[model samples]
Target: MSNGKVYLIPNVIADGTQEQVIPAHVLSALSGIKHFLAEDVRTARRYFSSLKLFPSIEALQFEILNKDTDPNTLHSLLAPVFEGNDIGIISEAGCPGIADPGSLAVKFAHDHGIRVMPLVGPSSLLLALMGSGLNGQRFAFHGYLPIDKHEFSKVVRELEKESRKLNQTQIFIETPYRTDATLAALVQVLQGGTLLSVSSDLTSANEFILTSTVAKWKSQPRKLGKVPAVFSLLST
Candidate 1:
């Protein structure tokens, strides 16, 4: 029997924005997939239901695949594929396997000779970079920054220095509640001339994207509230 293919499905970055952000083709691609791996089954179900793609979500099978999932048992999670059943991987938000744990499954598929197909979708990092007016050709995404005030400042400075040396954009994300704090730290630690970009609630009605110098940011501070945000910096 032929092995089943693994489909990497993308989820909406924000609630109620699927119609705006997700492509029509993605829904069509998901029609044949009955088995799924998701970080949060409930959220995944709700998201799929919002699409109104399936008449009954109960007919689908969902397996939990999160950061806490055991690596040794990955085979079991993917056993359905070995049985010739195609499985879809859905992230809590954004594209699967970018910063999500879905990457592990993709790696396993590659190692075991299973076909892996990634569907087009919204990626906050890429969107932020594209809007930041920064060097998209040379950029790196550091998933999350240090939380400690001192450590955060130190790292921000180092990232700024590296950005200046390489002319590369440095991107990172922060907890929604910590968005303002992270912005403050960036403004305080980076040089006055360093360009900083903060993109919040991307693809949503309240979407916000701004790229400005550290000095300008400090001069006109804005509250980002507790919303998902992506931050990028470029030192000229």
Candidate 2:
């Protein structure tokens, strides 16, 4: 019933902004995809409900692919599609496999000779970069830094040194809720004048960008809300 393989769709919801937005285009693009691998079925359904457009998702077919999903379950779920159908894998928000789930599906798809196509959509990584004013010619998405303060500090120091030597832009994120603590740590531990760029609520009405030295960031009492965000640092 299919040409076996999984496709990663970003569906970068809501103007592709990180502010709890879901763009209409994401669904429109995948209207033909009867089968989808959702990170969370309940949440995904609710999102669809908001559009007042209901697709008989359960009738179509599905493979539950969450961070908590087991590897064995994934294999069996994907096995039936001996001729793999084009699966639309979605994250809770933004692109899948970019700080999101679907890594297992992608890996398995690759091993089984199933084609994997990633559809273009909203990505916080690029969104922050575009406004950061940092040299985009070269950059790196280092992802979330370690939670341990000591390890995180060490990692930042190393990244700072690495970027200086390589002339590369380094990016990272903290759990939305723990933003204050993480920002505090960076403001305190990072070298006094380290240039850092932070973008919050990217693509939303409340969107904001702050580019300044660590010292200046510390001086400013502003705090990032629970909105999606990205932080970037580059060598001067």
Candidate 3:
């Protein structure tokens, strides 16, 4: 219910052979409606620049908003179309509002009467689950966990418990710098016989999808360093 015809754009992943593709048609359809509130202005700007598409700066369109912006000003910046303008929210990558700043904007717009339009594209988490061959029908996408070691441990324990009780797949991610540590913690803490699916650098040249018990996962080489990734676990 976010106000004023909101459009959601996705960022596609590139395999070694295939090229990276952005939903340019999504942009084309958004012609003249140039109010884009992006998560990372730099990344968004890079995206358009890579495509050689110059956006209408007159409409106050560009990608480069701060993540720590004031709630009121943020809402005002992303307010749904009042007269005749439409707002577009794009994540640094993938679907907006899933795990990006756009969620706040979307909620604010909805509270006021702004319409939200969600577009489909590559989602690393979704893709990981799809190919995980786990309980796809019942899964939870727990966005990045707290970086605090103790807090992260508690979160993992709770997720493990929920996964066990609901027979659901718990999917979560950590910052790239903490990937190895996260895996090590899981290996040390998770109960025996727990099934884990760790995917690293997915859809890229160094892509790796591995499924094993927590004990076995510890033996594999570390995941990609300091980059985005998805980690999934399933219970018996």
Candidate 4:
């Protein structure tokens, strides 16, 4: 029997913005998938229900696939695919496998000779880079910065130095609650002329995106209010 394909599905970055951010083709592809691996089953159910794609979400089978999931158990979690049943992977937010634990499953599929198909969807990293007016051709995404103030400060300076030397954009994210602290650290550690871009609550009604120098950001500070945000920096 032929092995079923593994579909990498993307979830909305913000709540209630599926229609605005998700394309019709992605929904069309999702309609055919019944088995899923999600970081949070409850969130996945609620998201799918909001799309009104399935009459009964209960009819679908969902398996846990979060950061805590053991790699040794991946083979069993993906058993349905081996049985010729296509399985979709859904992350808590954004595209699956991009800074998400879903990458583990993708890697397993590749190693085991299973077909993997990635559907088009919203990716906060790419969106932030596109809007940052920075060097998209030469950019690096560091998933998350250190939460420790001292370590965060050190990393910020190092990244700024690297950005200046390579002329590359440095992109990273922070926990919603730490947004203000992260912004303050960046402003304080980076050079006055360094360009910093912050994209918060992307694709939402309250979406806010700004690109300015560290000096300008310090002069006119704005509160990000504990929302998901992506930060990008470029040093000249």
Off by over 4 Å in 2: 13-29, 52-58
Question: Residue 174 in model 4: shift from native, Å?
Answer: 0.5
lDDT of each residue in 88-126, candidate 3, tens digit only:
777766677777777777777677766777875677888
In candidate 4, the residue pairs with backbone N, CA or C atoms under 3 Å apart (3 or more residues apart, or in different chains) clash, namely: none
Model 4 lDDT tens row, 1-236: 99999999989998999988888988988899899999999999999999999989999999999999999999999999989999999999999999999999999999999999998899999989988899999999998998888998899999999999999999999899989988988898899999999999888888889999999999998888899999999999
Which regions of candidate 3 deviate over 4 angstroms?
1-4, 12-21, 55-60, 63-66, 219-223
The local distance difference test score of each candidate is 0.94, 0.75, 0.71, 0.94
Report, for all candidates in order, the number of backbone clashes. 0, 9, 9, 0
* TM-score to native of every candidate shown: 0.98, 0.85, 0.84, 0.98
Clashing pairs in 1: none
Q: How does candidate 3 fare on TM-score?
A: 0.84
- In model 4, the number of clashes is 0
Task: Report the lDDT of model 2 for residue 186.
Answer: 80
lDDT by residue (tens digit), candidate 1, 89-140: 9999999999999999999999999999999999998999999999999998
Backbone clash pairs for candidate 3 read 2-110, 2-114, 2-115, 3-113, 3-114, 3-115, 4-115, 41-63, 41-64
76, model 2: CA deviation in Å?
1.6
